[model samples]
Target chain A: MSAVAYYLESAGIATTGISLVRENTKALRPPRFLWVTFPLGRPLGLPGDAAFQRRVVLAALALLDAPSGPVLEDYPEDVPDLPGDDVFACPVRFPPRASGRGRWGSALLEEIALLRPWYALSRERRGRTTVGVAGTLVETLAERLGALLDAPERLPGTLAELTELKRTLADLRAFHEEAVTAQPGDPPWREVRRLLWRESVLGDAMLTLRDRFDASGDPRLRAFTRVLVPRGALED
Target chain B: MVRLSDLPDYEREHLLDKNLGPLGPPAWVPPGTPLRERRVALVTTAGLHRRSDSAFDLTDASYRVLPGDLGAADLVMSHSSVNFDRSGFAEDVNLVFPIDRFRELAEDDVIGGLASNHFSFMGAGLLPEAYEASARDLARILHRDGVDTAFLTPV
Candidate 1:
């Protein structure tokens, strides 16, 4: 890919990239130079074939002598596409980590960060379906917490209401754990929502605690509140 | 075929002897010729490639080319997932495959000036014909540039 070439050139590696896709080359910026007009994904020729790869490499190296100018050297425009064998079929396996933790741990951490807006941006860009679902759940939780914070007067007075909220929160946590542990090909979005439900419960509890402190107005509580909440909240 | 390791330690003192056949007379150079002053170039098969370029797809096969000017800060590496800095090939990779090291030796008055460019190729191809052709072309370029010797490093 031209991106690879650009990075290498930036790294101060003397390189001239050859590719058949003209547009790919055009998209690249200056300073990291390359030669266009080679076929896609086969810069050094076909897979498992030695001679062709060598010729391509040699041709690329020869560009170094081209009078310090950056230019695209198109090979025979008429060379027909030689359908090659599938080269990427071989799967690469990584060694097991000593801690026994797998990619799932990293996935969970990513989900936690996704609960925030700035972190959500990174998660969305990864284009993973699971992340999108998790993000939606986090947004919902934030909205509920926002409403509860805005209206302490409307707080649930019954234990039944509180129990229902707590139950939903427990279910959400279960879902979050499930989503985090889901392997590839597992339905990820569903799991994300499950986790979001779990986190919302915790958010509700925190909001309730804050509201209770404000309602009590105990001297110590008021003193603590004065230190914790901004002066603007006290005025409100 | 002689195994280089099988050669007695005494005969393996020189770098050239290690490279060339030990039993044969050394390749002739002119009298007053400075081995230290010989222009040296480098070629590597580490798959050091530009992202913009097409990927080199051959297994056990590689090609060589004279690289453009590059430095450590500019390199974007991708072959293995290992960290590049830990590999300690920074200076060598930065200088386009240890040609800078050769240049350093030259600067210390140990060798001659380096060739203007060095070569690189991803070492994944299996066939030799193309590599042979490329090497021949490289040899021709070196001859044209009056290069006295070259060092090849297969990745």
Candidate 2:
């Protein structure tokens, strides 16, 4: 990222950047860098947290004017673990009765099946979701995902397939999130993340698949899937 | 939140230890220039692209050119880091990519004006050579856009 910043500076496009990973920014020593102690994947702050996010942006941009040899300013604000006030929950009740052969796999399939109803409910209530931004119909995409889950042995070989898989995983979480946050009395982001990645069928399925990939002796699949697997799912 | 300095030695080792070799002496162009009078643009490694555009390739270091007029609803993060939850990003993209804030700044004349197009690149797992090439390419485009100042955000 400092390379990019330095390139921008060399181009005479004065640059300043916000960094979630302070070490990387510090080592690169860009013309201007703001080290936000915010968690990875969220350099600005949290979702729906416009004011804080705006403040972070303003702070980072403020560095552009500082007399700089190489600047990595420390942002003073704290980013909460769960930054939003609105809560989320499993819209549907328990007793997911997916009829698959495997235990956790069947439960995960059940959760996947549950997504459509929850997604539609949220769409009806809020008139939108963060999922379809991928521009594919969620229902059809779900159908396509079945094959991938069934054959976790063969991971995506090309960048396109890998990207599709990543977006699909993001879509899955987004659909679940839109569904959960649709109702106002649910849990915060961390709790919801815990629910999905620590306690739910989806997390179990991912861990199971991660182990399978690791055992498959497919180094690329193992390494990449290791990265994509949710943190809580892996940790706990 | 844990201040990086307080993390366990093993846990913080990767964060504190580094040997990024020095480069050519940095050429600093002093800024006597007032920000409000310059043409400004946004550049982010936030993996942001238009709803209609193809997402960034996590492995490849290529980037997308998005129109500056895009709003919160029309942007999405195709970034592949699972370290951060997308829920916040899913709810409001400003958490990772704050183009909306840039618009507000332009309107208030805190900065000059937004360039006609903005830029985004996925910042993970890219080869160093590829990343440098794309960054240089983006620099050329920024120059063509008449952008004098860039507000960059990294996710």
Give the best candidate by TM-score.
2
> Which stretches of candidate 2 lie above 4 Å from their native place?
A80-89, A94-109, A117-128, A133-135, A151-161, A184-187, A231-236, B5-19, B22-24
Cα lDDT of all candidates, in order? 0.37, 0.67
- Report lDDT (Cα) of residue B67, candidate 1: 48
Tell me, by lDDT, which candidate is best: 2
| Model 2, span B68-101: residue lDDT tens | 7776666766777665566656555676667777
* Residue-wise C-alpha lDDT for candidate 2, range A8-110, written one tens digit per residue: 7876778876877777666666788788877656677665566887788778777767876788888999865553534334566544433243344445556
Note the DockQ of each predicted structure: 0.02, 0.54
Q: In model 2, which residue pairs have backbone atoms overlapping below 3 Å?
A: A47-B88, A88-A186, A88-A187
User: Model 2 chain A: which ten-residue window has the lowest total lDDT?
Assistant: A94-103
- Tell me the lDDT of candidate 2: 0.67
What does candidate 1's lDDT look like per residue over B17-107, in tens digits? 2121111111122224354656666555555544333333323234435543544333322232110111112212422244444555666
At residue A93, what lDDT does model 2 achieve?
A: 55
* Candidate 1's TM-score: 0.32
lDDT string for model 1 (A101-161, tens) is: 2232333334434434433332343222222212236435434433444454555445444
